[model samples]
Target chain A: MTALSALIRRDIRIALRVGGGALIGVLFFLTVTVLMPFAVGPDLALLTRLGPAILWLGALLASLLTLDRLFMADHEDGSLDLIVMSRTPLELACAAKALAHWLAAGLPLIVATPVLGLLLNLDGTATLAVALTLLAGTPALTFTGMIGAALAVTLHRGGLLLAVLVLPLSIPVLIFGVAASQAAITGPLSFGTPFSILCALSLVSFVVGPFAAAASLRHGLD
Target chain B: MSLIDLANPTRFLALTARVLPWLAGATAILLLIGLYQSAMAPDDYQQGATVKIMFIHVPNAWLSMFVWGIMSVASLGTLVWRHPLADVAAKTAAPIGAAFTFLALVTGSLWGRPMWGTYWEWDARLTSVLILFLMYLGLIALWRAVEDPSRAARAAAVLTLVGAINIPIIKFSVDWWNTLHQPASVIRMGGPTLDNAFLIPLLVMAIAFSLLFITLHLAAMRNEILRRRVRSLQMMQANQKAA
Candidate 1:
């Protein structure tokens, strides 16, 4: 327990100290959100309708941009080897790192989403939906991101590869995230179906992604 | 059967070489008949002659998914059993899978222009297929990006397994989402919706395409094995010269 906590805390400290990745992702989110309105023209109604999808997509892509970095720094500095050889299992260490990543990247994106939601001309209901959907959906990103990170840890140019690997695996999250948000915006949303589906996806990734990542790390070392 | 029956590279090479010619000949015969049947088959009342593209389009789509399935199973074999040749098999299969995917997309687009009145629609089947193609390309890219052969194999295998999630999504995306693509006809309830006239030709083409993939896969695997041998030989020669 203490080891896990230390790992998580160490990862959080590294993420916070770097800070550039979080800033770039948030700025990218804001830029794309603000740009779509101009490109599509001032159809406030249309913007409001698509606001959730736009935010969700932007968040997905933005979070993806930082994924390759999740382990690249550690891998390059040889810290990854240490982590792999640590007393705690690599799977647990991966979970801790993923949690730190979610906190540093996914959590902030969700918190900023509502504010960005307004820029896209989203109404109160849509803003709330967008926020809620992002909140539920981003954990899948962190989990899957760890898998991509582990896979690409040894490569020189892995940013694009990480996107390719992670995005396809992330389709379920994208599907449910959009659905949940759309349900929220439009009338007569039961919400339970999409919400549960989103949770199921997150739960699956949370459980499975760590082990897959650990396996990937082992393969890398081998 | 012994687990290490395939551990010998020379044995694998000899075995594949012996079977490849037969597979290639069978592929040729099957493809010829299949193409002829697909060409001669009657047009659909709703879709007219363009519907005939399904003979090629559907088979390519089938092989696209089917080849990926094969690759995934091979990947699991490689990872679990540490079967050296399975990695080569999976790696060799990637481009063939990509080719099938490309054909599916192109033929689908050709069919779409006349049938759906648009070259592309953001439909579930088409979208999933596009993702599948991307996954193939990514695997192939990873194969080239890594320097070490074993490392490359492991990385690509991990990717193949990770990307396996898209297979089910591709199969069922049409059912789940309200999309422009039509639902499953042959495989769904009430058994074989299309007429036998068209279905037979489609089946022939599908079988022919798969045979062609196997033939091509064997040829490519042989080439890959030869390449690895040549690489090792060159390294040994260089070392000997330096000594």
Candidate 2:
């Protein structure tokens, strides 16, 4: 437990302090959300209707933006080899790193939802629904994205490959996250259905991602 | 010979060389007969001549899924048994799978343009297929990105298994989502209600496509084996020179 906690703490500190850390992801999320209004034009009604989708897209992209460095920094500094060789199982270590990534990178995107929601002309209730869905969904993105990050870690240039690998896997999360928000905002359908599926996706990825990432990481070891 | 015996690359190569010509010959014959049958089949009362596209479209779609199934099994061979040819099988199938997927998408769009009045729709079937195509590309990209062959194989095997799990989810979710494309007609409880005219030709084309895939896969595996040999030889020469 201490080892896991310590690993998490170390990852979070690096994410907070290095390369603009969580700030970069949040800023990128902000830029993506803010640009949607301008691109879609000044129609407030359109923006409001599109708000949940824009926010989800932003959050997805933001998580992906920060995910590339999940193992890259450790791999660069030779810590990944040590971590792989450690007494703590590599799967647990991977899960801890992903959890730390979610805290530093994913949490802020959800927090910024309300403020960014206003720019998209969303109401308080609607923004809250979007935020709730994002909160449920981003962990799926982070954990799944970890597999891609680990697979790509050995390559000299793997950033773009990581995106290609991760993006399609996240489509279900995007679909359900947006669906739940849409259901809440305007509904003939119930929000619970899609929300439940979103949670299930996160839970499944939580179990699967660490093992897969660990396997890839071990295979990738030089 | 035993499966393990065939795992030897030289044995595999010899076996494929013996089999390739027959496979290629069968594929050509089947394709010719299938196309002739399709062209001769009476036009659909609703779809008219455009129904011909189904012959190509449906088979391509089936092949797209079928190749992934092959890869998934090979991935198991890699992870579980550490079969010598398993990674070669998985790696060689990816590009062929991607090609079939691309054909499916293009032909699906063509069929849809005439039937649904649009080249594309965010329909469940279409979207799921698009995602499958993307996954194939990602697998190929990963294969290219990694420098070490053994490492790439293991990494890709893990990924393939992940994708196998996702395939059913993708299918189910697409079904749950609103879609314009018709639900399963062939594989349902009733079992393929398609007319004999269309069914016979469809089956013929499907067989042809499968055979084509086998022939191509065998050839690709052989090439991969040769490429590895060349790589090792070049590395050996470099080491000798350095010494």
Candidate 3:
């Protein structure tokens, strides 16, 4: 537990350090959210109706953009080899790194959600709904995305391929996140149904992501 | 012969050499029969002749998923059993699977325009199939992006398994999302509601298409094995020159 915690802390610190990956995700999220209303037209009603979707998409893409680096940095620096050779199982190490990534990168997107939400003309409740769904959904994105990150780590240029590889895997998360948020915003349907499913997806990815990532890392580095 | 015997690329090549011509012959004959049946089959009173598109569309749709299923099994062979020809099977299947998926989507869209009055709808079935197509493209891209064949095979195997698990979840979520937004307006085109006249041609066509996939997959696998041999031989020649 201490080792995992330390690994998480080290990752979080690295991500928060100068020229790090954490905050840039939020900026990308902000840019995406801000760009939506321009391409979509500035009608307030339209923006409000579209708010949840825009926020969810922004969060998805923002997290995906940052995910390509999840393992690449460690792989390049040779720490990934050491980590693989360590007593702590590679799967646990992967989960810890993902946790740190979510804390540094994903959490910030959710934090910035309400701010982006306002720009999209969403009211308080709607904004909260989007934020809440994002909170539930983004972990799944980061974790499943970690699998892509691991697979692509050995490649010299993997950024665009990473997105292509991960986005389809992220589709269910996007579906449920947007669905739950839209339900909260306006619904004849109950929010708990999709929200619960969204949570279930996150939990499933949490289990599957680490093992898959570890397996790929083992195969990749050798 | 057992799977182990076929694992040897040379044996596999010889087997395919003999089997492929027969497979191709069978596929051609089946396709002709199926096409003839589809042509003579009575058109639906409601959809008129546009209904004939089902004879083409439904088979591709079925094969789109079926081909992925085949790849996923071959992926298991690669990652678990580490079968020699398994990667070749998985790798070659990707493009064929992708092509079938493309055909499925295009035919479905063409069939949709006259029937649904639109080329596309965000219907659950359509959306899930679109996601499948994307996954196929992603798998193909992953294969091409990786330079090493063995490493690429393992990586692609992991992805294929991950995709197998996700496809069901994606389908369920899309269904939920679609239903939540609005109830399905049209009766599902390829359901049990298909009549005997339609069903017969559909089955024949489905079988014929599966044969086509098998024949192509075997031939492609043969080509891939030969290509790898050529690559290894070229590398050996380069090494000899360097010496």
TM-score of each: 0.52, 0.55, 0.56
Q: Among all windows of ten consecutive residues in candidate 3 chain B, which has the lowest summed lDDT?
A: B181-190
Which candidate leads the pack in lDDT? 3
Which model is ahead, 1 or 2, in terms of TM-score?
Answer: 2
Candidate 2 runs further than 4 Å off = A1-222, B179-191
Ranking of models by lDDT: 3, 2, 1
Ranking by TM-score: 3, 2, 1
Tens digit of lDDT per residue, candidate 1, span B1-243?
A: 254765677877778788888988988998899889888898777778987888888889989989888898889978998888889889999999999998997777677666444454334566467667767876776676555678788888888988887567655743454222333222111128878888888889889898888888888988989998898998888889553
Q: Which of the CAPRI classes, incorrect, acceptable, medium or high, describes model 2? A: incorrect
Q: How many pairs of residues collide in model 3?
A: 0
lDDT of 3 at B241: 55
- The CA lDDT at B148 in model 3 is 71
Query: Candidate 2's residue-wise lDDT over B110-140, tens digit each?
Result: 7766654435444456556767886887787
Which model is ahead, 2 or 3, in terms of lDDT?
Answer: 3
Q: Show the colliding residue pairs in model 2.
A: none
